[model samples]
Target chain A: ADVAAAQAASARQDSLTKPPRALGRLEELAIFMAGWQGTPRPVIDRAQALVFAGNHGVCAQGVNPFPQEVTAQMVANFDAGGAAINQLCRASGADLSVIALDLDRPTADITEAPAMSADEVLDAIRRGAGAVDADAQVLVLGEMGIGNSTIAAALAHAVFGGAAADWVGRGTGVDDEGLTRKADVVARAVERHAGIRGAALLAALGGREQAAICGAVLQARALSIPVILDGFICTAATAPLFDADPRLLDHCLVGHASREPGHTRLLHEMGKAPILALDMALGEGSGAAVALGVLRAALECHNGMATFAEAGVAGG
Target chain B: ADVAAAQAASARQDSLTKPPRALGRLEELAIFMAGWQGTPRPVIDRAQALVFAGNHGVCAQGVNPFPQEVTAQMVANFDAGGAAINQLCRASGADLSVIALDLDRPTADITEAPAMSADEVLDAIRRGAGAVDADAQVLVLGEMGIGNSTIAAALAHAVFGGAAADWVGRGTGVDDEGLTRKADVVARAVERHAGIRGAALLAALGGREQAAICGAVLQARALSIPVILDGFICTAATAPLFDADPRLLDHCLVGHASREPGHTRLLHEMGKAPILALDMALGEGSGAAVALGVLRAALECHNGMATFAEAGVAGG
Candidate 1:
């Protein structure tokens, strides 16, 4: 972070007419962006939402009501500008693209063995990262995958060392029976990979899209491009990144808190708070897309608002 | 409330690809608006933020650091497009207007007696309601007055029967002594105006700007135009209306929960939850101005999003 830019933002904030901190976290977000952009004023001229669509092997265990084909269907829906994320992008003036990663090549069910080999996870991450436009000022990470929440819960349980049931939730319309089956799948995954950790743990329990998100976040930070994180499956992918480098979150904003039980724990682990808390459970970066308006509005205030001296108002 | 329109919105929601209530309260808001607008796709075409500037009598109590002069100065800032709310309106494509209501004449010190004559309060409300253009599609209620939170606290305390301290909070910036003084002021006002309720309570404790906001909200509802409520002072002004007609709130959306303690109790009283909780406290309808973007975006999604059949995606 650029301390000089952040300090400058604080100084400018002090000159606003309202009492210091009246803007609350909105002020903090602006200051953080100012520092990250190395300017007292920062703007988001172009934004993109990258949807990583994949399929999970855990669906074989009847974890979710939807068939694996739903992932491919949602990807097509996104391409046709008919998905939730599509309308959100149109509303926020952000571009939307679907990354159709492998869908038929489901990995070994987490309850039985390691989900994916390390090479595969790393390769998927790199592919995910390469798909992003380096010129885009900001990115919103989203995912569309059938039964991916199952992988998310399993991964979180392994890394966070929680009871599997505590981390699992009824994702995408899972009934009580389906919920129990998902929890059982996660519990067995934890037992199957009891001692794994770090990158190894990621490869052991993560799904294709989850690995891609982890990879893309790492790439975005390396490129100094900010990313907005969506709901649970996407957030769970960050567990390994948090383990690798906590500061990686400096380049990200939590769009909204997901209703998924694991997402709340995952956010707690990241030590980040969401900008919106609408209990939004639908993925495809819908929450982050809605938040794009808020973030852009923050930048507008940061750049367009006048200081007390300029406004001829009393300083805070 | 238009039950037929609401039913249509619900039917349309069921046809969307997401599961029932997957978007949380956001979906509900769109549905409500669709019903109220008598269209499946209700949109806010023209929005306005009405900032009612006035002087508070309780400023004499040293309840805040800023003097009453700041209210007029901020109104000038609003006219110059220099305030936070001005930037917010510009970002959201909403019009901003500054109403220079009588400010030199502060209300009677509420700790001792009534703030304004019943006629003056009612006239202020009428004046406020008239300021809103009939052509405006939506209104965002805001206020500009130092120590107005004291008036808000007093009004809420008298109407809601809470302890004075529960309703009192730092308005602009208050020291520990000032906070205690503000709370003491509220306590005294609550005791002084014991059993005063409804329109009578408003005249007894409300500031000029507070009364106007109340009037504007009521007028908006009468015109079938929706309002987005800002922070405590503006929101507290509506307590009597809530007591009189709970249906009036069907036309309002609580933009964000203010940092003030009473705003929570006030929203709880209104039986509504804020769309955003940014902890924003500086009012010029700033929170509501920001919410205009979300509201517009919601309309965009409702209008542009394709249903499951249209998108050729599987139903929920």
Candidate 2:
């Protein structure tokens, strides 16, 4: 009855009010709701970007200039409190946790994150859930890895079921030939995992970082915590997340639309709307971190604003 | 030397062999420059809500329940300047301006806005340009006129080129019969002005307030001032402004994607990107005015954020 009434009211509203003007007002209302709903309060514990660092075997194909060693080294840098992502996390009041998993070699005290096995992914999820404070939500996610995009694209294709070319993109600025090779490699991986589906797809082609992100996202929702989705590659890795559990979307917010074409398609497929669209393609959860500021402002407006009725003004 | 070096360095940046992080950091530099260029002192000039008040001749066809006299009375209320929009403006650090352009009755200093003749609109453009200070900008544009949406839809059809049903939406809760009449009225208006195009279509079917807005927008751009476009009706009315000049787009930051289907089409035609999407159908430029708060914040962030280099962080 309520839904029917609301629908009827909306139809009546269409009949009564002017559409353009009303729609403009509604957009403001949605922003208000998003900002209000996902507002972050200062808790005793800090938020963190759980960067699950990993490597793809496909990088051996010379898809990127960086060696697999850089992934582990960067993990060490993050653990040693160096690196741009760490600095951004520091600036945004987020704790930096570097988890090295799926690498041929690993770093110390950075948590021996297992490879993208189902059990390892599940353990990562449990760990992320445990790490987050009861009073605060976690913004756990992945970081840079050589050929991570290929792994992510393969995972997305297996779960989302589109052509690899449609899902795969030029990760880390590939040349035309490299892009074709990257797409082919991802397609082969997707084809290899045709039998295993859903969360298993995360296990197959997803980087350790991506598997950790999938775990974090699932766990965050179970704990009633909110998550901010970053760029294309990270989002691709987490594609199996929605296929495994649709409810995870309720606890997530898209931070920004990337300049990459795939990111927009992913956002549309997930039925998510981004908060900002300044053509962001950076993937350190940088856009999401910036959006956290806007989210804070939105909450302030909703919680603090005096509505028309409260302010003794005519609303209509 | 610093400026030259910066430009020269920027020219050579693409060729630089750097990590992926370098590209991510440079875009912010462009944003910072753009924001800093917009304002030097970054003082918040209390904004003004200028509501153009007028009436459409089509209202005489029994297209609305409210008598055309209401337009003049609303103008008087605005002249006394105690309308809801006026009150909200005053409360939100916004001054209110009531330009009684097409009121049935003459108003004293309600600002003699003649019938939306081309000369009048051009003069209005000059007047709108004159309203802003050298350092400050007006952040809102609104209107209040009886049966104005008829003019709005006709303008949308003329500019956007679609069926009347596609563009002509319910203006003010008209019933099925009323909607038919409203569509018929708009279709006739569109047919009547087949030869007329752009601003001329607006002048023929548009209300006095709309012409003033068209003028205001043009002037705003000439003076490098920005205007917050309101919802469906206001957008429909302003459609011709874009057709008249494309440079005007730089000055228009769409506040919301209005619910009216026509509004979305109009926004697309104008090449203005909306900042919010709430399905709001309210007018009076309230949505646009509210969105300015966020735009201001974006400007602040762009201009004021400390870069990695400045913050003594590693760029790569």
lDDT of each: 0.82, 0.58
True contacts kept of each: 0.74, 0.16
Q: Is the docking of candidate 2 incorrect, acceptable, medium or high quality?
A: incorrect
- Measured against the true structure, the TM-scores of the candidates, in listed sequence, are 0.97, 0.69
Model 1: lDDT of residue A26: 78
Which model scores highest in TM-score? 1
**Local distance difference test, candidate 1:** 0.82
lDDT measured at residue A67 in model 1 versus the true structure, 0 to 100: 82
Query: In model 1, how large is the Cα lDDT of residue A215?
Result: 80
Q: Candidate 2 lDDT, tens digit per residue, A1-316?
A: 1234334333332332222234433323223333322432212143556666667666665666566666665555556554445544544456656666657742111112212556766665565455554445447354667667667666667777778788766666677898888777767666666677667765566566776677777666665556677777777767777887766666677766767667778888888887666555656565665455444433333233333333333323
- Please report the candidate that would top lDDT against the real structure: 1
Worst 10 residues of 1 chain A by lDDT: A34-43
Q: What DockQ does each listed candidate score?
A: 0.75, 0.17
Model 2 chain A: weakest 10-residue lDDT segment is: A106-115
